[model samples]
Target: MKTMKTLLSASLALTALSGCQPETEKPNILFLLVDDMQSDAIAALGNKNVYTPNIDGLIAEGVTFTRTYTNGALCGALSMPSRAMLMTGRGVFEVQSDGMKIPECMVTLPEQLRANGYQTFATGKWHSDHASFNRSFAAGENIFFGGMHPYEKNGHCSPRLYHYDRTGQYKETSFIGEEFSSKMFADAAIEFLSTAAKAQNPFMAFVSFTSPHDPRNQLPDYGKKYKAKDIILPTNFLPQHPFDNGELAIRDEQILPPPRTGEQLQEELALYYGMVSEVDEQIGRVLNALNATGEREHTVIVFASDNGLAMGQNGLLGKQSLYEHSVGVPMLIIDPRSKKHGFKTDALCYLYDLYPTLCDIVGIEIPASVTGVSLKPLLEGTTDKLRDDIFLAYSNQQRALVKDDYKYIIYNVEGKITEQLFNLKKDPKEMANLADAMPQKAAAYKEMLIQRLKEQQDFCNIDTPLWWKDGHKITWDELINLYIFE
Candidate 1:
């Protein structure tokens, strides 16, 4: 055999002769996750009431998925399941989260990338368990493993966090409160990006911010920029929820009680907008750091929120409901090398789909364990749609299905079942319920919802209907309840 150098030269010559070229550098990935951000909360996304310049910039330079949502129904805390679904690439009924621990999935997005020659760094809030977080990231700092940042009346309290642990023990924790949460996470992100720039291997940085969630007291100065009286109320805002679809007793609803004063809701909206703007500023800092690095050329940015929140929409103030305000989330995928920018697709999709979508973006093989369908076609201009209809549930209490801008909702509060249907195109506010007026359409949608619920593995039983053939549920006392309403 020839010498090693001669052999390499000969191999290269043969490769060139065969019309083969060297592989291009794989792109770096930056996944930015926000907490409790609704689809319409961003100023760039047509929310005139908010000020999110940095996030708006991402929207300007990326393709937005206008109809992205969470897994719809989850038990325990909402954030945990939403993030779990994102990482594992599975639906709500598919994954099992207990005590905020990630379910037993075959692979996580970061873990898969790490196995495939990518160095992964994570910062900020990771509501999943320590073991999962440790396995997911190659290294991390300022890792907040809690639900929400600890809050005091004045501002944020000392919150516990952890540095990366190679052994996955994560035993030691630090109470870091010197800086606000969003700034702390952005600081960690900038540091990680700096290190990533020096590394030869392609890297992934996940910066998750717990801002704009609850305890919106971090940046008092930002909150001061907005007037409470100027905040506009949602068309569906009501002093009280029309009915207890269950979960009215949760802490989210208790943030402000029933008969919500106009001043109270306005103040809430103002502070919430300010909180989002604060997070947006911190995010801008992180983006500036990225641009300063050489790694910016081939990096792809994925901006998304875990789930949406209802500040005062649908007569509710929490995320535990299955209404549009509660389920829909903002999503954007920014590829720097691509010419496609500021595009949007209303093709419905869920948060879990990011796993396959990211894999497709990075040229990695999506594992068999991932159940989410990739949006690579949509991103690459090969297709504009992936889903025709969507399904949502809130525990076993509420189940909903939407197709072609028409929505059907079924409420099973303690087995006292009720139904609602709305032609969303005409009444986007859901001001009218056509369940009784259009019995035929309601019956059709109810059947469709049941079929979807079965396909989604809903826990609620559907055999209790007495006489709902092209009509309404003949409940044990529905007639009396109807008379009472009449």
Candidate 2:
């Protein structure tokens, strides 16, 4: 029953009486990634104690952008270079090794939309590698491959998963999923949107959901009506991390233990907003299985999150600090042929610019070893500024820059250097540290964060004295064997 091929009601009434416009057909993309979701954890992006009615109904019907970021903190784990800069749109030192293996000369946005005929699929948390999730899906299933697991509260955790492997050599990946994990990734994306609504090409379905990051409990009682003394702390909550932001003991800032309080960061924000309202009720049952597989108006949905989680904010709880609650995330796109209904774009983008903005929304081409930069003219609004300055690195200690309205951090643990600027529109919770009262605007944002760390080819040496002694040094047994996945 694979359908979709219409237009003949007298050529749609002669293209609606010759007004033209009907050429669209290629829009099926449901990305919806999530993990550590933080851009003000929605309640229509203001965080009214987080209940996220399906991520506040995709921020009131998508187009949200709100300054999305992430291109920082590697090996200290920024989920394998933020899912390898979102499947190789490249950046954060050009996603090769920090993405934890994805260098067959990049091309991934689901292997270029599964070599352009679409149908690409992949389920839940694949922190890059497994031969780039076996050159990005062409059929996938309940998979999951690290960055967190051990959730067990009533959903009786089993974890350990994987299914699609056409010999990208995933080799007998122990399938186990007994619910939990946003209900086994919304039941493997509602069994791949009911066999991708009868399949006849057009499909992308990345899915991926690790859930509110951190096994923040709540498996079934769906957070017993959110109670941690009615959680509410973060006015830039702090009890530590005043300095030594040299990852003050990693593994996500030792998940609690610093002087941190206010009733222990309100019971870890009531188990991180009750695992973000049970991953927003399993993303409202995977958007009601894409509207019971009618393909939710030809898909093109993109909601994001690969980084952003510092549940305890400034006193950090990880996402290795570039703060705005660990690298401002949560983005959306929802193109049903945009006219920007719920639009919001503060546009200093980069989530590896959503793989050349989903290859400029399906017309495809985009790949010269991709380096991001395509929000598709801010999603057809034709322009809203893409960048003037935006850089952040989190390895050889730290470095940051966000030009207009200031925010210039810099630190270097070993050699003991430190500095911070922050005027993020009059201190957006950076709690005043105008770097010696704005030393020439913090040395012109440390020379635009050293020209944005040589235009994001970062290894971050910031004129080192010791800056992690020429970078990439790692060993706590190689950061626990680069986040165990075997």
Candidate 3:
């Protein structure tokens, strides 16, 4: 396979030493992406409650990026901008949010792969605008144009699934019936792999699954797999957020009535974990399909989520918050030919970095407009880290800067200003806010955040001192009342 020089050298050494023969052609890429999955939710990574044999298998067979974060969302529905950044390899401040429309000027990951003679195919959710989706994939099936829908329904429910012909036309299809989203997407991918067995050119299958997002529902047996009472609550779980972080009235936060109890949240967590396990079973089906086609050893499999979710952490039920449960996601890249298995790196990276990193892995030139850096060094065992600091922003209301072992967060909604700082090394859950205790360090991080925002051209009108001077008083009762509808 055509890969980075370092990877090529390492592969050659392994092949020579292990007496394994090298292929002369390019390898296939199976891009498996999920929606609204938390980083710590995977069974292999640390969570004991979730049963994810297939995902854990991938972790055992690949290199995992332990510390991967999304740049941030452009709206309350974090999936929109997060998918935009992922597809285009652009920063949060640079992409369009609605439908995650990729600009005409930019080249997407699939588009570049297609240009290089790879048969680019996609299935499942396509949250990006139709124009970009059409431009990226040569063929698509069982495509859900919208972001999310009710995962569980008692009656007959069939969300509209469309088929995108390579000729820029979409055809309505009933190919996807009442099957669960994960199973339906996996079925289509397995079928595609079976069909692709005869193709001469290499393929890039972009299998995107919308599971474990919301309407936390799995099959009856899968849902019953996890017990609500057995699921443990997050360490930072609370009945309500301490203050109004500006998204108190969002639809995700309104999933359940106020005064969320531990038992009820645990039940939701049980369903969420069930859905994760259900998706893992479907992933096993797709991997079996690849192996059945004899392409398992020649294919590169990547597993990641669009963004993360805050299922009960920090008293939030959605991804609108800046907490680790909301921003961090699990990422694994598996190269079947590589000898490195079960290797994990704690290198700081953004989700968009996958674009350039995959391009480098496959020896394809990265697009000019792509701003993400390639993690080829880390993959090739040449480096341990890619980035030291990460910048975050969401809808011009929240801003965060993570450097060293400390994370600084600033929230300005209306005329109120709130700052939070946490030593992530000590308190990864962000339970302690050191803003008032360490004022000088907080100010330094605030300045660093502002400077980083400037570098990203994110001029969101963050009037810090103005709000600091005006001193808008916000009480816990007032913040709680915001979520109470009239």
Maximum-lDDT candidate: 3
Ranking by lDDT: 3, 1, 2
TM-score of each: 0.88, 0.35, 0.88
Give candidates' CA RMSD values in order: 10.0, 20.1, 9.1
| lDDT: the better of candidates 1 and 2 | 1
- Sort by TM-score, best first: what order? 3, 1, 2
- TM-score, candidate 3, is 0.88
Worst-scoring 10-residue span by lDDT in model 3: 477-486
lDDT assessment of candidate 1: 0.76
lDDT for each residue of candidate 1 in 75-177, tens digit (9 for 90 to 100):
5367877887898898776665322556445588998887776767888888777788867876776778878865553344355666665677877656565
lDDT of 2 by residue, 3-97 (tens): 11121122122213433233237788888788887888778877778788877887788788887888775567687788887787876776655
lDDT of 3 at 440: 100
lDDT of 2 at 84: 83
Query: Which portions of model 1 show Cα errors greater than 4 Å?
Result: 1-24, 152-157, 218-224, 465-486
Local accuracy of candidate 3 as per-residue lDDT tens digits, 372-464 = 989878877867557879998876578899898999999887767899999999999999999999999999998888788778877454545
Clashes of each: 0, 0, 0
Worst 10 residues of 2 by lDDT: 1-10
User: How far does residue 474 in candidate 2 sit from its true spot (Å)?
Assistant: 22
RMSD of 1: 10.0
